[model samples]
Target: MNGAVSPLMQLLSEVETLKKQIAESEDPVLKESVGSTINAIVAYGQEAYSEMTQILDEFETFQKMEGLTEEQRNSLLAQSLDHFKDQMSDHEKDSFAKSCEDEYKGIWESLDGDSQEFLSTARYLGYALRMRGRGNYAPVINEMCRVFENELKKKIYNDYIVQMTQKQVVDMDSNTEPIKTAVSKKKKNKDYFISDTEMVCFIEALPSVKNNQSGYLSELKKYLQAEKWDIQKLSDSQYTKSAHNYIDNYRNDSAHANLMDEKKAEKCDRQTHKIIKHFIESKK
Candidate 1:
């Protein structure tokens, strides 16, 4: 969420101006011009503003008092989805289990503020039920797989930042096992390989945001070899290459294809939730 410019600020300024303008403007063409200009202002704030009307719009009301914290904003998102699922008569044969209600609340709250914000995109994103052509199954699977991979990156990057703070690994190195072993065009089978694309996306995509990503890949490898971390601990501080292998293989088969049906969507979400709990468990 863009806390710098909240929805309440927009309402106080832009909405009031629009109301005054609408009252004063008598000509239809002039009113339409004014309306379009206000709409354009909303558009410039963020493209997601259009799609996430329900969740994002809530900020306008609450931000009047004070802007939301990362967790509060995420809670709002979770609440919106949960409210709909519970109130609206949606086909239960389509929704993902543990992705709603108290189950989701626990998972969402378990994460730290930053991690909650990082993972909240899963809440409002990829409305598989809304996908017209592809049906509900494929999109749900795709979204869950995507969230899993991104969560891994976030967790690994978070650990990497901590290591830098403590001067553990080279002040800027990350010990991560990527989703793919090789940087190939193919993601379907991917066979067995490790690629830096996932970590690179975090490190290089925005230097200001990922300030800890300073050292080269070679430094991390050198540190790992010299320190001799066990394979289980070496894997993004979660599990070994085998865990990564299993995830990659499962995701490859589940996502990137529309072969699965609606029931599989629930299965994907439920199974993913279980594995993510393991991934986020605090390692001693």
Candidate 2:
């Protein structure tokens, strides 16, 4: 193998060259044997590539630990072992953040204007909360909730307006009272943003609107529930109760911040991403 090229890459390259050579050969039996061998080599190369990728991920994690003193690093390592056992190292948190970013970057870029704005902000905050420590995660998580609710409120309100407009124009006589009532209600709440209670109402009202879907809110609820998150509490109002609790109990504590303990931050980070990913997927 070449010194510069990875073993996996070298094997893959050799397999391709062998495949080309076998394609032009006259011996059928030799071709079949060599083709089988190439297939085996390709599979092994794929496994090697996966292993190397994981090693690279770990190395990247290690690089992030460079600035800490030995005692700090040892404490971090000990804490990680307590939470994650031998399977996880100090780099796991960073790895998780990086993996989520890489996996969803393309999908996030493809979102509609409002969705893109909300998700991009959420992702940035989540990354910051996980990777940086300025006691900013509290405010960031709060803002994340606000952004999510604001975007959802806009979507629901616009959808409702479109439905009402169509009904008013098409079925003028029959829908006159309902349209008048809806318009009055909307006009009365001009500055209203959906609170958790209002979000539940909006979701309940979705089935009545033309082109409105049913699965989004339900799926979001299910996802949160499966994660053991407090969905009803999250949806009862705009604030993320769990996130606020963490901020109040841990992040805001004077001693905790200087310790550089990331367990609480990691939890909030993951939950924020989960919420963002679920919202994006539901919209799609």
Candidate 3:
């Protein structure tokens, strides 16, 4: 039976056994207290198992990858448990943290390159949330924009450049001049490094590298649309347009004044997470 049963199933079976024992006991008050306790345990276990199932479903793709081991699966689960730590009791948090940390160093090592980066970014976002909770909102928002612009945007721009120039073979003396001129023009016109408007334009210019679809552009446009942002009116660098605008506004306002409050910071934190999730999903 043990061999055939899943861990959750085994837990449920144990709950049933406890219920049976309670039913057989003769002490009325003892039965009442123990019955309530058993119900609570069963409810908690069911909730935990449901969450674990959802996490496993999310990682189903990872599990299908070649060379994944049982040990890696367990580690992945532990790493995932970190996200739910806040919802757990103090005792559960302690136990979960201890288990996760034992194999924490190897957790990312066991994942694929993309998975590793995804989880690392997510962990960083968690840190950003903690910082926001501690009332360090400006720095966290600034860092979020920096990651979006410098890391994600720069990566996409460089990849696009490589893809566009991949087949060209330039001569050292003659042909190289045109290639250099083109690159210079692309950089000047795209100007993604300077501001969010240029970054949006740069993203718009990029051809889709996957299935004839630009996932990054699509995801970004959806976010901008939801924010009621008009791309045409975003020509001015000072204008607040995209989610990056929130970062810029917060930075500028906070530098000269104490304008950032906890509520606004929490909203910014949520927007940052949404932006990060878009970047992560686009990579997939």
Using all chains and alpha carbons, the TM-scores for the candidates as numbered come to 0.36, 0.34, 0.32
List the candidate numbers ranked by TM-score, top first. 1, 2, 3
Task: Tell me the lDDT of candidate 3.
Answer: 0.43
Q: Pick the candidate with the highest TM-score.
A: 1
Candidate 2 has which clashing residue pairs, if any? none
Q: Worst 10-residue stretch by lDDT in candidate 3?
A: 1-10
lDDT of 3 by residue, 1-284 (tens): 00112233455567778788788989888788878877877786667656644643443333344564433543453354344433444543343334323423433233334333333333333333342244433333332334444443344445444443443433343412433444455656642223443454444433332333433344344444454544333322332245446545643332222434556655654565455444433432
lDDT of 2 by residue, 137-215 (tens): 4333333343344445454444554344343233333323433455455566543223333344434333344433223
Off by over 4 Å in 3: 1-136, 162-182, 185-194, 205-258
Model 1, span 3-121: residue lDDT tens: 12223234436866886888898989889998887787666544433434454334233333346543353344345443333322233212322244345555665544433332233
- Candidates' C-alpha lDDT: 0.42, 0.43, 0.43
Q: How many backbone clashes does every candidate have?
A: 4, 0, 0
